[model samples]
Target: MALKLLSALDAAKIQLYHFKAIIIAGMGLFTDAYDLFCIPPIMKLIGRIYYLDHHNSDKCSVMPKETQYKTTPTAVVSTLVSIALLGTAVGQLVFGRLGDRAGRRRVYGLSLGMMVLSSLACGFSICKTRNCVLVSLGFFRFLLGVGIRGDYPLSATIMSEFANKKTRGAFIAAVFSMQGLGILASSIVTMVVCRIFAVSSNEPKSETPDEADLAWRVILMMGAVPAALTYYWRMMMPETARYTALVEQNVVQAAIDMKKVLDVPMSEIAEDSPIRLKPPVLPHPSYPLLSKRFLRRHGVDLFCCAATWFLVDVVFYSSNLLQSQIYHRFIKDNNDVNGYKLAFKVARFQAILAISSTIPGYWVTVYFIDRIGRVKIQMLGFLFMALVYFAIGIPYKYY
Candidate 1:
């Protein structure tokens, strides 16, 4: 039998509200993916605009020694890329707790606001020197990362709480699927911006400082659009019934809120009834996460989740953040192209790869995750990844 407090949520029929919740949650992820993937192309553009002469001038022996090759250090570029990740880690820990304490709806809008403001800040990063510019950009991006990371826990929790159990998995999957769209959007926007600047410039083969500077800013600032668009809807959303009924122990309010959401009428109960009188309380015994009982009960599961996530992120971020480097190594004949043109080429390549591979992979997961089960899919994915890595590595090493 379903728990009285949860029966309404579990038994409720899937409706338009479910789709709205998915879109609201998914748009946050879309913004997150767009902001994150957009950086690599911009990073490459930065190198070309600010450091190409220093890094590349030595390669061509005939080049003049006096050539101004102002280069931002590799460490600085890496720092700019990695600092946001660090902020994300912190935000997840901090906001996950905050969401529980303050309620989801109240804290949800804060993250979106931070994302919008910080994205604009990142686009407008300005300073007298290359190092200063990098520092400014890094700081804003770190803040942006914090906001983006908060969405993960908040969105998942909200969607799950709002969904009927029969279709819960699908709703959550749909929300996460928006991330692929965000990635596609980033690539498309970057390609379009770069192409426009490249074609319009009279000296398409030579770097134009003005065009290069404007292109990156435009890309970075565009991340704010999706987040800004969704903010009002997020704010207007009611607190999830799960949070109110279970967390707050306010059964009456929970029923009222859910009635409106599900478009179903709720029966009125006596004020003196047990459901109306129960105070907010935690379902589990009050114990710290590190308590012996918790460790004994769930330690292994927790450890596995943490370890797997760590490994996955390490591989995922490294591959994505360094994709431009891989592209440079494979395509070395772009000397005649200007920095903006090169950036366009990189963006187009990434977009093609995303459309052909990454985006499809997300949908495949969405379709099969419920039918095949998470464990089997995860195991198969890991096995495939391992085999592919070995095949590539062994050949390259021996040859």
Candidate 2:
């Protein structure tokens, strides 16, 4: 009988320094998760501060007078709320290119810087100045999205390149998984800040600046701190061996860099095999999008991944946004008139939904992604999502 071990110590050599790179790279991803969560909470605060009621109110009356005259409802607030996701979609395209061309580390550094600046801007910007608020908020959110855009490819590539194949799966997935933790932490912070502000003002979470500004400012400021600290840390980290090899085409330098991360002697790094260089592939200037053979083959997969992300976000966002509506319509007892309890229930529900709905769904990907492949899982997700949406649209009558 043959003794076939899953991971041989000799075959699967991983040094301590590689773990360091993973930690540095993972920080960028953590920031991405934190920023994404932070945006929604800020939007919630903005809605409350401005008294953006779904029902009739002073805040809703703030829409354009022309629209008001026509009785056609304006969706300015909703559009503002969606700016981050829209920005993220654009960022994904722009920063993906930037990462490929300018190098991941450079683009990653730029992304983190953008995130820090955007978060600070978001915290301090004057909401009272409508145009200023609109422009700044949109610009900053877009910049933040650009940063987020780079994080996915950069972090994943860094981790994969630095790690030995034996541990690559675990390390890469672990880094991505931390995003969930950052999300949970951001939510807790937002809820706490909102609670404090709501209590201090003795106003409902539904109620303007009195109930909203302080909490959102604090949360946005909190989101910036991680980016700023991680920026310094990531700055100190070295670029991956794979990226270095591709750029310089120096096999010896690439091996040395790999050994540096592996913390093993030069000879022990690749079992005494001689390092050989290969010619780099140069692309033509006029290549069309579909002209790239490799990209064309996997283009559908890429589109499916993007569509899955879009759908997941839509469900996640809609589920979260509807919490207040659910509470106001069905859960809250109008006779109680105690806003604190109402807010508490809403917070509790959101916490539950965040835990039950979002976190598990993320893990389901981690577990089954390898088994089913990205396209199959994404297709399944989209199919189920469509079914759920259709079911919701049935709209049975209720009192």
Candidate 3:
């Protein structure tokens, strides 16, 4: 038993392409992050461009009129941001099943195609007519979700299958860490756009807020550029060898592909290695995925990981969507005032706060995850979150 365990670990070590695969899969995730987080910073901008401030008048407007220029309604803002999540939900359901059926590489490529298309569709949201623009933005956001959906399961599965066994935990975790990279990129992009808008915003002729709104469209369009490049990158890569072996029942081809990936000659390939010419006789009496053995153990791990992911997204995204407001409060409390400067300050401070919140949690999990196991860490994290929520909820009820 110890020998078998050691062999698995050894096999994992020999596997290098899996790490490459994780990076490739991570690019797709970066796209997901860009599409998902880009909305909030632009939410206020979109509202000003559309229903909120339909006219670009210079009159000193009153209460609701001031709000039209100053604030996007909570409901509208939530709907806009949540629309992307909705796209994610649909994309996940469709792409998850399709990826399993169509092969990971093809499905991955398809997801990218959708991403490029949907991102371009967002540009269409810059319509001259307000109603048309609002409708287009919502539709395109949902279209973006369609692409965002396929990423998680497909990336996780590919990253896991490709990774060397011993490093699987580290590789998967690292792939997710790139999510932060995408977020950081989005924030930077928004900052650049904001700077441009601020510059244009000061122009004698730029009295209209709609002129300022051009910044967001530029940012949205910038996101599509990376996805386009990724699509080109993905086009050059081959299908995962493990996926081919397990799903396609092509052991001979799997071995050949494995050799190419490992850069090993057939003669030098270890005879005792599990990459066999003959397919292993997986146990029968039918559906392995639905079997009691697979369900009780593997299923539970998958369920836990997914649920934890969902919960984290809800809290993190909600906080991010409210980031500007949070920063405004901090500014107000501190009695610091400057719209253009504050926008940039709030954005940077918010990014810093976000990094601070996530990094320790991420590092702690990354450090202990392999040693202690994913399931335990996930469960404990969920429990801690639940307890925090409960304590907060209890206090709120009493107050």
Candidate 4:
């Protein structure tokens, strides 16, 4: 039964269903990337609206009504930014194991459901007091982060399970490449919203106009649309044949799933079965996850993958979440730019990076990964990242 389903899956040609798998799975990643990082671009607006510098309220009317929005307190801002990362770690640990135990499809939509509800909650989180509103947002974002990161493992698993062996690398690469689209989408939405509601900066007062209050809410809520769509589509996806056959030990159910997904014929699959499955090569069948032997066998490989991914995420999300602050600090602007302009500038910069760096790198990996190999490509990537980081960091003060 294993051989029948496994061999058919391996031998199947690329079909429309394969692309469906990519789109369905890829959009989860898209929503995750967009929602997770969207906060930074609009955080200034958030501060202006919610954390309005009331201590300086007396100054607002006396000092030419010039917009004098104080920067959000550092501790609060850090919590807002880092809380999502914390939620992501928690979600991955929880959902990953759940996927293994219950079933991938069973648990996949739970993350997106959390994302849609939390994203909407963030958009509407208003309170009479400043602290109440900020805390509410933080809590909702924590839940959103849990939903966003849950897609990380599930998408790759689905893509790998469906893709033919010959080009499985490209398919999985395509799944991650969706992150670029997500980032770009978020930036474009923020930019358009800011532009449409462009408020003239008050020369006398430092407070943002009422229009910005609306714009930021729109930005936070917009993440729900795509996430909701992805949820519906993911629900339609059938469970992977590999799980149904190999893990569940249900050959008939696995065959039905394969019939729906792959291009193989019914006759070839339904014939009286006498074939045997080759046991996948492993050091020991009894070596369970977290066992000492399991660790001994895969320890170095595990460490490298985890450490590299960890470092990369640290760099990626920090730069994304702190981009506005970075631009304000070092880019050396002479004119007193308003919050809307600052946000637009940051959005533009992120768009450029997505187009030139993130998007291209992702697609290039998809195209060349199988031909050139994963390890070599990863090394080349680290080399470039190292060079760019040094170039930016070494001259931090001079710029």
TM-score of each candidate structure, all chains considered together: 0.89, 0.74, 0.80, 0.90
* Candidates' C-alpha lDDT: 0.78, 0.62, 0.67, 0.79
Candidate 4 stretches greater than 4 Å from native: 51-61, 67-69, 126-128, 199-207, 267-285, 329-336
Give the CA lDDT, 0 to 100, for residue 63 in model 2.
62
Give model 3's TM-score versus the native structure: 0.80
Give the 10-residue window scoring lowest on summed lDDT in candidate 1.
265-274
> How big is the positional error of residue 219 in model 2, measured in Å on the Cα after superposition?
1.4
- Please say which candidate is ahead in TM-score: 2 or 4: 4
Backbone steric clashes in candidate 4, count: 9
Q: Which digits, one per residue and each the tens of the lDDT, describe model 1 over residues 1-399?
A: 115648767877878988999999889889998988898778767866666555565664766333434334678768888999988998898888899988898777888898999999999897636778788999999999999888778988899899887777767878888887887899899988888877787763554455687889899999999999878888877899888876777877777777776765454221235565455455675777889989899999999988987887887777667666644554342445566766676677777777886777677777887788777877877787688668756775453
* Residue-by-residue lDDT tens digits, candidate 3, 299-319: 988787678777888877776
Model 4 global lDDT (CA atoms, 0 to 1)? 0.79
Alpha-carbon RMSD of each model: 3.3, 6.6, 5.2, 4.0
> Mind giving the per-residue lDDT tens digits that candidate 2 earns over 41-98?
4544454334323454454457632221111123654565567767777777787788
Q: Which candidate leads the pack in lDDT?
A: 4
Candidate 4 clashing pairs, residues 3+ apart or interchain: 65-205, 66-204, 66-205, 66-206, 67-205, 67-206, 67-207, 68-206, 68-207
Candidate 4's TM-score: 0.90
lDDT of 3 at 232: 79
Write one digit per residue (lDDT tens) for candidate 4, span 273-325. 74334333324457688889878999889999999999888888888778767
In model 3, what is the error at residue 139, expressed in angstroms? 0.6
